[model samples]
Target: MILSTLDLNPVIDLTDEQFYQLCQANPEVKFERNANGTLVIMSPTGGETGNRNFEIGADFAIWNRQTQLGICFDSSTGFRLPNGAQRSPDIAWIKQSRWQALTPAQRERFPPIAPDFVLELLSPSDTLPASQTKMQEYINNGVQLGWLIERKTRTVQIYRPGKPVETLNNPSQLSGEAILPGFTLDMSLVW
Candidate 1:
């Protein structure tokens, strides 16, 4: 079930540390924090969505291992964006140099940097508008590349800084473009 902004107001606001502790305390629940300090507690995805997420993450993992281009993360990795939002994309990658710049403590907690690349796979419960807004947020927070994939519509929205959002309908695959260099996501399994 989707929790609207109105439903979140009554909940006690939490400091970043408190939110991190809460997440650690309840490892099974997925949580996100908005720029305005709204806490979002999300339910786990269904089996199909879970499987698709796994496949997508696996592809990134494999690519990272081969090229050693950067660090790759699954959905569970929380990132503290520059805009003060704590978000965890379905799949994310950070440049090695950028990741190395973080102190060990910062790396241990919610990382205080936006990923170089991010992918969000839309599940049945996810609202399209919300997801699009999130993609825009990533761009605003210094993410170089972002993909919002909608399985139901078989469409992908590509986000790049200073460029208009590009939409691809039923694409066979998606290129990482200059950001990832040679990494391509095969959509055959994704769709």
Candidate 2:
């Protein structure tokens, strides 16, 4: 995706509601907000990216369904991070307890909570540094685990709190570890 950022600072600092309204008004567009209130617009994915995203989401959904561990969100689901940024990871999951703690109202709109796990797939228009920065943002905002997958290079960068990122090359699969027990992402499907 070709991600664009627009700074609406000093001129128009949109509140959470206004941002949500803008997104609702333009459902065809995907928007994200940085901690500085800059809006990031994401272009729609091409066939390869879309199909890969779907496959990743399906695996996550299936795992969640079987475990009844938490809720799974696709790319369209926006989350209000603790640091005042709005993000929509390619695939996200929240622990069941954490999800159940939210009020119905909170659940209806962008839930003001960081997901326990997040995944971002590098698209054709994406750069390594940009994707790495986004993944770091997730970690700083209290995400327990994250993966940045680059199909072109067949590599995966793993993120975790208080640790340096772990990079894997052509790994057969990924284990969710204790964070998502028994969940293994089959790299064959992704690669």
Candidate 3:
């Protein structure tokens, strides 16, 4: 929903003023601001596709048990853009400690920063280059790693800090690596 004022194309250009105008137009959107002045926006991404939900659910059921960090979410989670804007990732996770630091009042709504790890499952509506830019936005904002899962190809792009992105097609195990040490993501179950 943070893309409301901007284009979701490869350029990834949007203004905060336009974003607020869109928000004023759409009451369905919900916004949250963190202590650091970061903002998160959550909006219904349109009607859900039942099958994708099943895939995401299955992935979470297995992945959450291995890590102390929060599991995963297809529900909108905000990420601070390089330009101080925010974008809603398809799936996001925060380090348990970072989240624990929040006050109960702050936890009532979504937190206003990027998750430590993020997964953007590419829907038919998303553009690849724009999605890549979205992943970069999280990285710039301190996200340790990101996954750009392409549903059509059944592949994923693994983004790690200070390294080139890794493209995996039909990966067997989605390891947490150092960022999520000992945490294993068995994306094998996703359809």
- Against the true structure, what is each candidate's TM-score? 0.94, 0.98, 0.68
Full candidate order by lDDT, most accurate first = 2, 1, 3
Give one digit per residue, the lDDT tens place, for model 2 in 39-129: 9999888888899999989999999999999999999999999999999999999999999999999999999999999999988988899
Best by lDDT: 2
| Candidate with more favorable, higher TM-score: 1 or 2 | 2
RMSD in Å for all candidates: 1.7, 0.8, 6.2
Model 3: worst 10 consecutive residues (lDDT sum): 1-10
Stretches > 4 Å off in candidate 1 = 1-13
For model 2, what is the error of residue 169's alpha carbon versus the real structure, in angstroms, after optimal superposition? 0.5
Instruction: Order candidates by TM-score, high to low.
Output: 2, 1, 3
Superposition error at 58 for model 2 (Å): 0.9
lDDT of each: 0.90, 0.94, 0.63
lDDT score of residue 91 within candidate 2: 95
Per residue, candidate 3 scores C-alpha lDDT tens digits across 43-153 of 444444336655665666566766545746554444444446555566676767777787775554445556777777766655688678777867777789888887578
Q: For model 1, give the 10-residue run with minimal summed lDDT.
A: 1-10
- Cα lDDT of model 2 overall? 0.94
- Candidate 3 structure, TM-score to reference: 0.68
